[model samples]
Target: MAIEHEQLERSSLTRYVSPKGDFIGFRDEDHYKEKLKEWGLSSGKGAKKEFLFKERNYQRVVTIKGYETYGKSDEFNTLVIEFQDGNLCCIHPAFLKEMQASSFGKESMLQVEEKDFSIEEQASETQEQVEKPEPKLEAKPEPKKPKATKPKKEKEPKIELPADKVHFTASVKQFALTYNPFNEENDEVVVLENVVIVEEPPIELGLAWCSHSKTLKKFELQPGDKLEFDGKVAKKKLAKGKDVEEEFIVDAAVQYKVNNPSKIVKNG
Candidate 1:
C-alpha cells in the first residue's frame, strides 16, 4: 500500500479580517514577533514557535493553501492559535513557517474593470463652455533662502552598574500591587498589612536600620514573608582587600508592604 498526501490549492479564494477572520498568518517576521509580543511572550531573536504557542492569546485558522473553506476539519488543516482583543491572531509555528514559504497567498491579483469613456465625455460637454486662457504676468522673483538643518542630541550611555550595586532603589519607580488579593476570603480582612514609608527624616544609614526594626515589629515578618521596597539611592563599594563589594550598602526606601496571615477567631 502507498500513502498519499492531500494536494493544496494554488490560490486562496477567501478573505480574512483580523480577529473576525477565520485565517491568520504572518508573512513578515516582524509581524510574527509583534503577535508574540502581544501574547506577553518573548520577542527575542532566540524565541521560537513552540514557546510562542504556549501563550493563551495566540490564535490561527488553517486552510487548504488557497481554498476558501475554513474551520472545516475535512477541507482545512487545524491551525492551533490564540486570539486576543478579538482583533489579531497568532499563527502556530508550522503554519507561520509554511505560509511564509508559500506565495503571498490570495492578496495578489487585484480585479480591474473596463470603463466606457463615452459617458464621461457626455457629462463633460453638458457642464459648460471653456473660457479663454489668462495672459501670463511677469513679476519680480525673490531669491531662494538657504535651508538649515538642526543637529540631533546624542543619547547618554547607560552607566555600567556593579552586580551588588543593582539595588531595588535603582528601579525607575516603586512597584505597585493594585489587585485586591483577599477579595474572596471568608472574612473581610485587610489583604495588605503594615505599609511603612522609609528613607524619610534624616538621610542617614542608621535610618534604614531603624525602619527595618520597626517593620519587623509592626508587620511581624515571618521566615517567608514578602516585602516590597521603592526608592532611589547611590551605591558605593568599599575599596578594601576582602569584603570590598559585598560590604557596600545604600540608604533608600520609599515604601514597603506585606501580606499578613489570616486572624484566628473563637466560636461564639
Candidate 2:
C-alpha cells in the first residue's frame, strides 16, 4: 500500500502497529486515537481491517521501532519495545520478512499469556462447617511514666563568630592627604594615610594647579576645595636627581557609613 509522507506519523525513531482486538502502543485507549489524529488519520483507517484480520486468525502481531522484545522465547508472542529515541514496532510473525528492510522488523519466540486462578463452589453444609472465626488481637500495656523536668538555661551568648556565620559591618574613618612644595608643579605630590603605600607615579598628571601659590604647581589630584590639607606631616625626599618622594597622612579624606563597625575590630 502507498504510504504518504504527510500521512506518516513521523517520529524521531520508528512507528508501531498492533492487532485490533488487543490494546496496543500506549496504556490509554484515548492515546491511540490521539496518535491516529497526529498521523493525519481523523480516525483509524486501515487499522480496523488489520485488527479484524488478526482476531479471526487468533494470531496477530504487534510491531514497534527503536525497541526490543522482552520475555520468554519458544512462544509466538513478543512485547514490542521503544526506548530512547522513541522508535517502536510490534508486528506479527508473518510480517517479519516484509519489515526487514525498514529497520524495525523482528520475530521472536515469546508468545504466552499468563494463567489465572478460579474459585470452586461448595455445598451449604460444607460452607457451614468452614466456620468464620473472631478476630484475635493482643492488648498493649501502658508505658511507665516519670515526672516532667524543667529545661536548662539557654546557652551563653557567643562572643566569637561561628565558623559558618558571616559578619558584615559598615564603618567610616578619616584619612589625611598633604601636598609638599605645593607651589612647584615639578615638586608637589600628595600623600595618603592608611592607604598601605602610595606608588611613586601619581594617579593623574596636571590634574589641577594651586591658584594661590606663585608657581601655580599642578597636582596629580585636585580632590576638591573642601579637602583640608594637614601640612604638618607633609615631607619630601629626593631618590634620584630632581625626583622627590612626597609623603603625608590623610584622615577622613574618604568616608562611608558602616552598618557594623565590629568588622573593623579585627584590624586592630
Candidate 3:
C-alpha cells in the first residue's frame, strides 16, 4: 500500500532533501549499520539485493537500492528500495531485517479477537430468529443509579515557548529509550528534571525530554548530573506506554521537548 501523507506526519519521522533534491524520510544511521552487521550485508552502499515484500496476502520481489546518508552528519540514513513498478520508498533498515523471516505488513494488521466474531455470529442468529416473531416480551429490571463522584480538575494548558534558543539549567533524571512510532523502534532519550530557563524567557519546566543526539553523547551524561545548555523548547506531550520505554517510567508528566541543545556544561 502507498504510504499516506498523514501517516508520515503522525509517525513524526524526519524528512530530508537528498542530493538529488528529492524529499525522503531519514532513517537512524546507527540502526542501519547494526542491521547491516546482523544481516551480514558487508558489501556496503550500491549493493543490490532482493527483498520479499508482502503486499496484502501475496509477496513480491523488490530490489534494495542500497543505503544512503544525507550530508556529512552521519546521524541519519535511508534504505532505498525499488518496487516492481519502479517506485521507490525510503524504508527503515530494521524493517528490512524484520522482513527477512516474517511476512511484512504484519504490524499494520488490525487484530480482532475470536470472541468478537462469536458475538457477531450470535447476533446474526438472533436476527434470523426474529424474522419468525412470536416471542412474548418480559419486563426488564430498572438500571441502578451511578454513585456521585467528585469532578476531575481540568488539565492546565501547556505554556507557549519562544521560538529562539534559550539558556537552560537542568539535572539528568535518567537515561532511557522512548518509542518512535514511525521507525517502530525505541530511541535513547535523556529524561531531565528540575529544568529552568536561566535567561530572559523565564520558563520553568519541572520535567522534560531530550534526544540522546551525538552532541549529548559526547558528554557521557549520567543520572544526577546538572547541565547548562541552550536549546529551543516546544510543547510535546510524552504519553506513558506509547512514548516512554517500559523500564523507565516517570511519575511526573512530560509536557515539553528540547531540541538541538548546545554549549552543554556538566556539573555535579
Candidate 4:
C-alpha cells in the first residue's frame, strides 16, 4: 500500500513500524493513528493489503500509547525508542523469537479494532493517598516605664583664723632697715609704743624686729602703722662670759616664711 508522507502524523519520540524494519521506531499516538489509518486499508494506487509488521508493546488494539507504562520506563517502551537526531529503534526480544513466531496470526490487525491490544498494566501501580495541614499562632508586646533621679547636697561657709589667736598688733613708732643678727640679712628694726608707762615711769620700748624691710619699704610706714605679727620673745639665757647676747622682740611673719600679702593696718 502507498501512503503519502503528508498523511503521516510526525510526532517526535513516539513508537511506530516503518518499512525499513519490524517493531522499529517511536512516534506519538498521532503517528500510531496515521500508521493504523494507512495500514488498516489501502487506497489509491497499488491497492494490495499491508501486512501487520510490528506492534507497540506487542499488544493488539494499541489505540493509544500506554502513558502509565511510559511513566515507569522513563517515557519509553521496550517495543520502540526515539532519538534526538530523528533516529528510530526497535527492541525485539531475541529470546522470544519462537514465541513471536508461534503467535503469528494471533495479533494481526485487519481493521483498527482492538483485539488483544491491551497496553500491559504495572503489577504494583496503586493510587497515592493525600494529607491535611495544621494552623499557626502569633505573639504580643509589653508596656514602657519611666526612670528615677537622685538628690543633691548643701554647702558650708569657711571661717578664717582670728588675728588675736595667731599674733600681737603694735604701732610702728620708728623704724630702720638694719642687719639681722640671726640670719645676717637686713630686716626692719622698728620702735613700737616709743614710751610705755609701767610703775608710773616712762619706759622706752626701744626697738622691735620686723622681717623683709624691702617689703616694708615697698609698703612705706613712717611714724605709725599698726602691724600685726607673731614672734619669738627675747629670752635671758646667759652666755659663757656674758649675761646674754643683745636681743630684740619681734620675729615677723616673714621669718616664719609666711607669704600673705602685706596689708597696712594704719597710716602714721
Candidate 5:
C-alpha cells in the first residue's frame, strides 16, 4: 500500500543541530513559507516526485516524502525526503532544489579539501612557535601608584510575570525589522513601549517585542497608538548588534516578548 502524506514519517531535520550547536529549523509556518517564496520553490503539495541529491562525488535518487510542520504552532517546517537507501531527512527546500543541478557538490568537494589543508598548515605553525624560545627582557624598577575605586551602579530589579494570561496596556513605539538568522534576512517586528500589566502583581515592561502577526496587522498598528490586549509575556531579549541596529534600524532595547495577543482594543 502507498503511504499517505499525513502518515509519512517526520523528517529528522527538525532536530538537526548545526556545527555551532544551534538547531537549523524554521521558526514558524510563516518562516517556512517565506523561505519557499525566496527560493522560488513550490510548496510541495502535489504528487511525490523523484529528484537527484548530490552526496559527496555521486548523485543518489531521492523522493519527496512531503512537507511537514512540527510543533504546536508549526514552529519547525521543512521538506521531508527519502533517500534510495530508505534514509529520511528534513532539508531546506532551497537546498534540495539546488542539489538538482549537475555540478552541485563538485565545487564543494574542493572547498572542503582547501579548508582541511588550511587547518593542517595552522597546526604546523603552532608547533613551530611552541618549540621556539622567547627572548627575555631586562626588568626595571617602577613606582607603585594607588588604584582608584569606582562606584558601582545599582542593578534594576527583575520584573515578575504572571503564569496565566493577563490584561496588558501598551503603546506602539515603532515598527522595525529584526534579524532572522534562519532565513539570513530581517523580519518585521513591532516594538511596544510603556507596557504594563493591568492585573495583580502589576509589572511594567519598559519595552517589549511583538511580531507583526495577522492579529496586529488587522488593527493596522501605527506608532504612538495605544493598545489594550490580553496576552502572556516572556523574558526575551532583543538583538542589539551594531549591524542589526544600522541595517534594521532597531533602536529600542526590548526586554520582553508578547505572545498570542488577543482581545485587542485600540485606544487611539
Candidate 6:
C-alpha cells in the first residue's frame, strides 16, 4: 500500500498503526525528533536511554524513516515509526499540530544602563564656574563626643516567592514511568513548550526562544492532555561549548500544591 503525500499537525508525539495494520508510523522525521525531544528520548549515539516499552537496559535509540498513512483522511489517519528495539509503536488517528505561536510579550522593559547626558552638561557648568572668582574658606575646631552602643532588632522572616504569578498551557509529549533498577515503582517526566521564539535584536538573547518547561510531577501525563500549570520561573542562561553560542530560557518549577489539575482543548 502507498502512503499519503500530505502533512498533518502532529502534536509533537504520536503512536499509531496504518488502517491495513501493515505499517507503524510516527510523524515525519523532523516531527519524530521533536517527539523524542518531548519524550525526553535521545537519539544521540552516545546517549543512553532506558527503553520504557521494552524490557531492556538503557539502550541507544536509533531512529529510522518510516510510513505515515496508508488510507484516506476519513478512513485512517496514522504515523509510522521504527525504533532501535524493533518495537513499532504506531499512533492511530493522528491530528495536525495546532498551536498559537507565542510572543515574549514583555509587559515592562528594563533599561539596565542609564545614559550619562548630564555629564556633558556638568562639564559645561564646571567650565563656567572656573571663570568666576573663588571664595575664601575658614576652619573651625570640633568638640569630642562619647561613643554609644546600639541595640539590635529581631530579624524578620524571609519569603522566597513574590505575589505576582504566571501559568502556561502545554500538551503531554511522552507519558511513561521510567524503569527503576531497585524498586518496583518508577518516576515520570514531561516536557512542554509554546513554540520557537525568533531572536529579536533588541530583546535579550535569552528571551528570544520559547520558554523551556520541565515535567510537573502532579500526575500522569496523558497523550491527549493539555495541562495548565501555575508556577514560578527563573531566567537561566546556558552557555554551549566554545564553538557553540549560548542560549537563554526560563526554568519553571511547579510545586505539588501549587498547580491545580486543569485541562484545556487538546489539538486534534
Predicted structure with the largest TM-score when compared to the true one: 5
TM-score of each: 0.15, 0.14, 0.45, 0.21, 0.52, 0.18
Can you tell me which runs of candidate 5 are displaced by over 4 Å? 1-88, 91-103, 107-129, 132-137, 157-169, 179-186, 196-203, 228-248, 255-267
Which regions of candidate 3 are displaced past 4 Å? 1-158, 241-247
User: For candidate 5, lDDT tens digit of each residue in 1-268?
Assistant: 3543322332222233222222335456655554454344533473224676665535566765556544333334467666754666667666777677676875654467799999999999999878666778868769679789899999998666776778999999888776655345566778899999996667888898877875589899889999999987777777542355554566556878887688999999
Q: Write the per-residue lDDT of candidate 4 for residues 1-268, one digit (tens) a residue.
A: 2332322322332354432435433244434433222222222243222222333333221112111112211222233433333444443322112123446545443322343233222222322233345655656555556557566666643322222212344566554344422223344344454322122332223333433334456667766666654432231111121232234323332111121223434434
Clashing pairs in 4: 14-26, 14-27, 14-28, 15-26, 15-27, 60-117, 61-117
Backbone clashes (count) for model 3: 0
Local accuracy of candidate 3 as per-residue lDDT tens digits, 23-120 = 43325555444444433442446333577655444555666555554422223456777665555666656555555556456553223346677889
Model 1 Cα lDDT, one tens digit per residue, 200-220: 332222111111222234454
* TM-score of structure candidate 5: 0.52
Candidate 4 weakest ten by summed lDDT = 60-69
* Candidate 1: Cα lDDT at 213: 23
Of candidates 6 and 2, the better by lDDT: 6
Candidate 5, residue 263: the lDDT equals: 93
RMSD (Cα, Å) of model 5: 8.3
- Model 2 spans with C-alpha error above 4 angstroms: 1-9, 12-74, 101-268
**TM-score for candidate 3:** 0.45
Clashes of each: 7, 33, 0, 7, 0, 14
Worst 10 residues of 1 by lDDT: 3-12
Cα RMSD of predicted structure 4: 58.5
The full ranking of all candidates by TM-score, starting with the best, is 5, 3, 4, 6, 1, 2
RMSD of each: 21.9, 33.6, 11.2, 58.5, 8.3, 23.8
Give the distance in Å from residue 207's predicted Cα in candidate 3 to where it truly belongs.
0.5
